[model samples]
Target chain A: MDNNTFHHALKIREDLCIGCSHCMNVCPTEAIRVKNGKSVLIAEKCIDCGECFRVCPVSAIIIDHDDFNRIFDYKYRVALIPSVFTGQFPDEISEKQIHSVMMELGFTHIYEVENGVEILVDAINKYAEQNPVQRPLISSFCPAVIRLIQVKFPSLVDNIIRVKPPLDISAGFIIREFAGSGIPAEEVGIFYVTPCAAKIAAIKDPVGESSSSISGVINMDFLFSKVLRQVKQKKSDTCAIPTSGELTARATCWSLTNGEASQLSGRCLAIDEIHNVIEFLEKIENEELNDIDYLELRACDESCAGGVLTTSNRFLTADRLRNRATNRDKAPVQKHPEGFRDISSEKQFLEDNISIDPIKPRSILMLDENMAEAMKKMDRVNRIMMLLPMVDCGICGAPSCQALAQDIVQNNAKIHQCIFIQKILEQKGEMSLEEGVSVMQDIWGFSKTNKYRDLKGI
Target chain B: MMHFEFPIEGGNFLKAGSASSQLKKILKQLNVDPRIIKRVVVAAYEAEVNVVAHAYRGIIMIDIDTSRICIQLVDEGPGIPDIGRAMQMGFSTASPEVREMGFGAGMGLPNIKSNSDELSITSEVGKGTTVKITNYLEQ
Candidate 1:
């Protein structure tokens, strides 16, 4: 009944989807509905968090991004590299070398999203100190988590820090550097080489902002091969690599869990992965985290390094990141005025508009669109639920006992669809399926003329 | 009107707050207002967690109508010795283990108090405790 205005970053190839309901069970938004043994995505409800993308056994979900050939559309292509990109490779290879590799891949300039993180972090620290409103101020870096708050935890929307993701800030930097210097914005294409599909969705249809400054998104999995090849091509070219001053390990470690929050001082709650994040959000909603100063919620296991698009194991990437940061000779951050000063002073954050249009409930329990009818069906469902054993074993095609109850009320299934109920009925052997259903209808006092009567035969 | 009841076992951290989650789900299915649902669920969760943390065994009864929701939690455990003092912030009687787990900062009753339209707690020191929380469906 609703049309989704936001761009969905992940698309499912319906032909490949097995309708196994794995994605449906795990979806935070309940965006996926399996009808007719095929997965159907309700676009309006989808946050494009890619939890479905990660869980799909058949890889039916594909992340939407610009093709590699799209880079040729602009005269000068600039790639915004996330800090997690550096941790994907060996610790010995510096981030500067990675920049050079991107240059080799025809990127004229490679700006670090970490630069944006540095500025954003400093700005957030200052903002928290200045405006002591609530207990735990939520971090807005992870687009998935932000949208999760919009969809599920609307009460905490005001708690989210009014800040843009690192990529948006980095794109702003690129626009300032090149656009004013007689370079048209169209001529300079700023692409994000991201480790997660959420970033792709963020660029296309950003939350809490009007339009993203970043031109396109290129998943890190796609660029890993090109970067790996370029790294091997000119292994000895040290001059092209930028200095350590430009690339600090502190900024680069944003890929790991709590990497950004560790830079900030105070009680910070960093939760990673969708399930863990959901759990923590429940606690936050419970007001159990009043003492916590900051809440960092990432939708990936080990943070962005464990993103669906990443090739390396998140644990390895995390270790590599720590080793790289510890071995660095320079200070954690440079004292240069250009980087921190611009970030801390100006504080480039978009206006907070996390209030997405209220989404309609994707209720699996609804038996009818009419309220009175739905309530009557709900009562019947509850009655049926009481009759069956509550084991949520999915042998009946429905996800759980509760789901089967809704199905029964909706006339999509019969009371005997539950294996436990079926087993009991089989053991009794006195009544046929139709008789059993009729008995149930009589016991529940449901009308014989109603839709539940149809399931009497089936 | 819809009524649901769920049992709660003390010290079962794993299953704590599940009843509240189920209640939230039911409210969503009924298409309750999002704001009202949040207020009711938060209050219910705090009451639910209190039972899990302090009570030996408890039963949560949720009664919903077109106009309001009433969550009544009755627990058989060590009842609060002093209800007046317990309402004060940061006065926690939780064990070291529960405190270490980042719970029992004595914010449970207060959280429920703030989120709900009406909250009443009645406890008998040696007997048990009963918490009744009610929230209107609309402002």
Candidate 2:
């Protein structure tokens, strides 16, 4: 609930962690550190990109979500599903069957999150037209990318489009519909079945906005398994649950890579994956890139299909979604069929509330808040950098020698934490051998340090 | 105050702007305003590319303090005969080869002038050029 620090849904369980340093090595922001045989996350530096979750070998990383029974608390339970969720299943499974299975599992209504995309496409173009100087308007679709910009590319914060993403717009539309039908807001609960940890964190602690209308978050893998189980056990398909209106081809593929970029008219480019995004952003920040009008950046490869909580292979999911979109484009549109709700009727209302407040930069790069003090600390860091071996061994509980130097100047770590420094001090008769072993024990945990067996035993 | 220098190799388009990138990192660590950092980096990048496109070899020296950042780019090459003409936009004496690689677009000096608070240039017609750029931290 503390908005000052980022709310990370990715939690590392110490009981299962072995301090293998895989997560530390893969983190794009260098937010992870090995301490006491466990990987610790620096919350302020994490953008919830799920890179650590993907690289964790011991399965110690877990994404937290709301309890399934929480949906029963409200009179009306509406599952806000994304297209990627449906793409997780085999091609034989129809979208109607998935909705029916969700209904059988106790959901009163099913709505596609991309229903808002019908309205967002126009909004994005309008936003770009109005802000002519803020070239290369960055999409706000990916929460991790938004947080990354705030933390790493603070100077480019103004380039992010202020319009709410499709998820929020869809949630707003559905909530308004329930209210319009005389259902009290408390009785209607909108639960978003999320594809990644970033979405959960965004719903729990949103940026540029105070709170989200989403009542709860359900991991995609959990719901995918539940629906798959029901589909397998079902004996008859005659439940006759009213299906939600089919999404347009554009809406169906809205969360995929190049989904938004292909729709926009300009010199737009879509870049997927966190590291690639960082690399491209550096060029943009340096003014090395020009004539770019828009950018669609996602934190995950293949976009939402490659979400950490997804069960199916990313390529297969994306392929299925692409096939589905192609089929939808070829099919004729049905006009107000049985139980089909037209979200387009609420487009005006969604457009009115599409804009969000300006996002402020929360840079974690500075050594100190005061420029004068930070300059002094930087000088000390440079001095320490010269003394420490730049081997980046990670034995010092920091990711690199530079990181340790910064930590030392910030008083979060000591200079002796570096093994190279410890040996130099010991040879000069400044510290004893017992002191050196204790330092290793403190960083790598007691058990790992105590078992200094000979390599010849094997 | 802190001082640092980075060497630049002329005609090495691949390594150009490395000094500006390093300077950008240092400014961010110093808690400089994001707008100010952008301007300082843009100016530095332009000066860096100028050295790569025109000079044979160069070095960038930077001095940072609480008040401002001053960057001096010195290059050994055929210096400009007319500093006034070089400062004008779209006035480049670069070869067609340099223009093909998207460098030596005469806007380099003009762009640097617009992005920095203060700018100066001194050149020995047959020897080299030294460009000094300063950006205020508080502004």
Candidate 3:
């Protein structure tokens, strides 16, 4: 099996899942179902937002980031680390110490994603000021949010800004510069140190573009222990990479919530958390926020700092980022490094290539294979729903009244399976309880009074 | 054709967009294209908000056939005094409180016109207003 589809970004380990339905209920996209005592993922319906991955109690959901061992295959490996990684450590360990630790981990070079973010911030500010789209241009930084819009609110597809994400921009720069460098093209590898599984999934299957230059993704949590070990070693070595001060304070702030909007000057709204993002996007869809210039939305609660894979407390990480930003006093340069300026600045971020076409909604009820038969099944579902109590009590093993009705129409469940429906059937004056029991036995293939209890073989 | 009717209580900000959300769900169950669902949702939501912001009470009636979905919002309220002015951008009769809450940016009707394939409005100044929006089911 191809690695990309082997288990998807969020994989459910059937042996560990307890079928509590917690993941199914909390999923934003409703992409999970409890069937036969296990949680099954509806692959096509899943946007891989990592909601289920975060809510799973038993750690049964595994992220499919690239194996760390893969780094050895290339002669030269460069790590593109998100700025949030700096805040994951103690403040005493300076930014310079972090890059040295990455270098010690077999990485030939460490390129902080913050640099790319600075250029992106500049690019966005210039684009929004010069060529504004329909009011409230939505930020396309979060891949999960982009996919959600694709599945849930495609009409707003035009609203998403067209710029490539910071990590991808960094990767694209590396790929563009590789030809001039003396190193063989095949020997160089680029890995993104990501805080969320959604980034890993996005690298493999991009929504806005045909492909990504990112070679692989490494979860921040996976590197937490490794970096800690290096910190304990306390070995110091001089590295060629520039420190956080080399980038703008605005770019480093991207690790914290509301960072993206802070870089722009306008009526920009920055919203975090999945639930709030949904509500805010609805307002945008209704044209209620037409006066606003930009909208920054993140899937994680506290933005990247609160990603599922990170071990550090989000609040502590955010405070650390603030402290670091204040300590760095250098101002950002208006011009970017050579070669990177043109690609990051000249391209229209909201152009045709980045605007994704709307996708069909997830199929919640496909009653039958044929359209006519499906219509008949829909009628059957409605009839069954009328007979149901419509309370959405999950006692019948379905999430809602509509789900139970759908199950009945599809022949996967019987109306008598509902306790209320069974009581109604038994209430008929002519039929005795025994007759009702017999009828239930015929339909359900189970005897109310078990003969096994009376066995005398012993 | 199928019909769905939902009552809308004016001044109920808590439940203002429920009807349109329900409409989106129903369209999804019927396997309507997501693009059409979005267009219908935007138009329906604008009409729903108009009813909530300016009317005493209203009813959202959705009629869906094989090829089209029609949303008719009829409300008992102080209707629009000038239809031409209402159709233009940045023209609203909403109260200051509604504007403060971000509901009246004067983009509702114009947004509906942009999202829908066909739209019609009929109003009696002191009696009521009816906004009919139609969107093609297929792309």
Highest-scoring model, lDDT:
2
Candidate 3 lDDT by residue in tens digits, A258-290 = 898887878888899888998898777655545
Which residue pairs does candidate 3 place in steric collision?
Answer: A162-A349
The fnat scores of all predictions, in order, read 0.21, 0.93, 0.16
Off by over 4 Å in 2: A1-3, A235-242, A333-340, A453-458
- Per-residue accuracy of model 1 over A1-458 as CA lDDT, tens digit each: 11346677789897787667787777776566555456667675677677788889999999878998888899978777776787788767766667667766777666667766666666677768875976688887888887777767766777787766667766776676665477888898888888887788777876666677787889898898778877877774533444222546667687579887787878887889888998888777756556789988899899888988888888998888777777764545344332223432333432231123322233333345554565677788788889978886654555567767876776766676565776687789955766655544432233432565565443
> Which candidate leads the pack in DockQ?
2
* Better candidate by DockQ, 1 or 3: 3
Please identify model 1 stretches exceeding 4 Å from their true place. Answer: A1-6, A15-38, A42-47, A51-58, A91-97, A233-239, A243-245, A331-381, A387-398, A403-458, B8-18, B45-58, B75-112, B120-130
Query: Residue-wise lDDT of candidate 1 within B99-134, one digit each (tens)?
Result: 887679888888789898999999999789999999
Residue B37 shift from truth in candidate 3, angstroms: 3.7
Which is superior by lDDT, 2 or 3?
Answer: 2
In candidate 2, how many clashes are counted? 0
Interface RMSD of each: 3.5, 0.5, 4.0
Candidate 2: docking tier: high
What TM-score does prediction 2 earn? Answer: 0.97
What DockQ do you compute for every candidate structure? Answer: 0.29, 0.92, 0.32
